[model samples]
Target: MTDSRPRGRRQAEAERNDRALLQAAREVLAADGAHASVAAIAARAGVGIGSLYRRYRTKDELFQRLSALSLDHWNAAAERGLAADDPWEGLAAFITACVEFGQGSLSPIAGAIEVTEKMRAKSDRGDELLDALVARAREAGALRPGVTAVDVSLLVEQLGTSPLLDQLRRQGRDDLLDEAAGARARLVAIAVDGLRAVHAEPPPGHAPTRRLYTERWRRRPEPAG
Candidate 1:
């Protein structure tokens, strides 16, 4: 009977499917970049093509959504970090969340789809928070002499793409996952400590600039006609 499938049941199933699709899209897009196929995403999600099409008409659209979601996650983490009374604790906490959620791993899909104004706005907001967070740490002498917000951003991106973390997430090995987390935490602690002024030795090469960081997301200009 049509009534047997209640609206609540339908809604819950739809939500569940959406979560699966998002997870699959993240993995496939991160792995394959712009060339990732919709079929692969659907397969990874364990959903039919119909379900994928129902939500996203194209793989680009799926990647676009994921890109936007990544910004949202980062911004949320940044805001929470900004709120912490202790500057170093706030910065460390935010960095941990960003890496744990694979926030910067979505960069592989950058420029694959159009970057909308909304996404730009979100990125700008995140930049503001990043600047504030870095300033707070520097004022407290918690961050190194020349560390910039872009440096922290780049560091988070580098750590977010850990192969072991990705593999453990895929394998779902409960036993090893904790070990993986512990390893990640250790690495993060080391990275964060290196940022402190107490450990100051000028970082090799020039510090990353905001332009260099944002360039990754901007579409390259078309060749002059």
Candidate 2:
């Protein structure tokens, strides 16, 4: 009979290498954005460059895997937000989670990768959850009328930049880190307050429908010249 113990050990080692590579990729990409080198990732994982190549033949392959993981994480956070009993609270929590994700591990890779159909589908589901959150909040009179889901989406994108936090980190100003950490939250609160019905005036023009919003917001490829 063929000895299988050696084969099993090799398989287990392969799995461990894969996990290490992925974890390293997450950290490197988060810190260095799309410009992160494969060598850097391999070094971070304490794996030989040859080993990384064995697992992921190319950088694009690695990036695609990371993108998938990010999508799964985003879906989980969205689900948690939907689970909250309070609609307004749920919306806020979801926005916060999204901002955190964008500022953390996945933001750089997310924008760098080609948008696959699978990514589009996941985005559609996310949009649906956002729609429900906004609708519920409006019904409860927590959100103002005429504030479309697109508006919230835009606000979240703006918050994801984390300008103050980034600046503080870059400056290594530990004294201000605590205050900077709350900057996004404070801005979000302000935006939400501004979105209140009592603070807003009536729109001059008709608001776009959901279909229109989706069509306009969806990223399309530029036509070949």
Candidate 3:
């Protein structure tokens, strides 16, 4: 007679494989960005290429799922900010969290995925959280009167792209690496100070939404064969 096992075992194995694939994809994509190969991800996951393809028909589909995971991360960060007792602290935490996330897992997926309505909705929710934090901080006289949520978001994005950090990582100089690692945080602190009410000045124009920035910066889709 054939050996028998519950159907649940197969389902559990499938779930484990899917989770492993996603985790591996995140790690590879974080280091290599959108150009990272599926083969690399499969190898990292210790799964066959056929296994990955069985779960996702195309690379785009896998990227889409990764994008969703990134958005969930942002949303969770926002929730933490919203939960903070001090409005200014909450806003600062939110900015720091976003910058850190971008510098790590979110960057590749951000550049890779095709924009979808579901992704847009998640981004909008994050924006809403930002708006709330800004409003609270402004009312508390912690943030400058003219500082908009967009300003904070843009600052995080700018700091997230630090060349010094990239250069240090490339050079592999242990002595300089320690200093370079703190550079982003130091810059974030400086920027946060500048957002105080004491430095208030009118913004030149309306700040662009996160959606607009994503649309402008997102990589063009690869051509079909």
Task: Assess each prediction's global lDDT (C-alpha) against the native.
Answer: 0.85, 0.74, 0.77
Candidate with top TM-score is 1
What is the lDDT for 155 in model 1? 90
Q: Model 3: which residue pairs collide?
A: none
Worst 10-residue lDDT window for candidate 2 reads: 212-221
Model 1 stretches with alpha carbons more than 4 Å out: 1-4, 167-175, 220-225
Q: Write the per-residue lDDT of candidate 2 for residues 65-146, one digit (tens) a residue.
A: 7666666766777788779998778877877787766624555554455666776787778778778888888898887778
Better of 1 and 3 by TM-score: 1
Query: Model 1: per-residue lDDT, tens digit, 1-225?
Result: 465788999999988998999998878766776677889989998999999999888876777788788889999999999899999999989998998898767878766577888888998999999999999998998888888999999999888877786777768777898898798889988998888788768788888778888877777665699
Candidate 2 achieves a global lDDT of 0.74
Show where candidate 2 strays beyond 4 Å.
Answer: 1-36, 40-48, 103-112, 167-176, 202-225
| Model 1 RMSD, rounded to 1 decimal | 2.7
Clashing pairs in 1: none
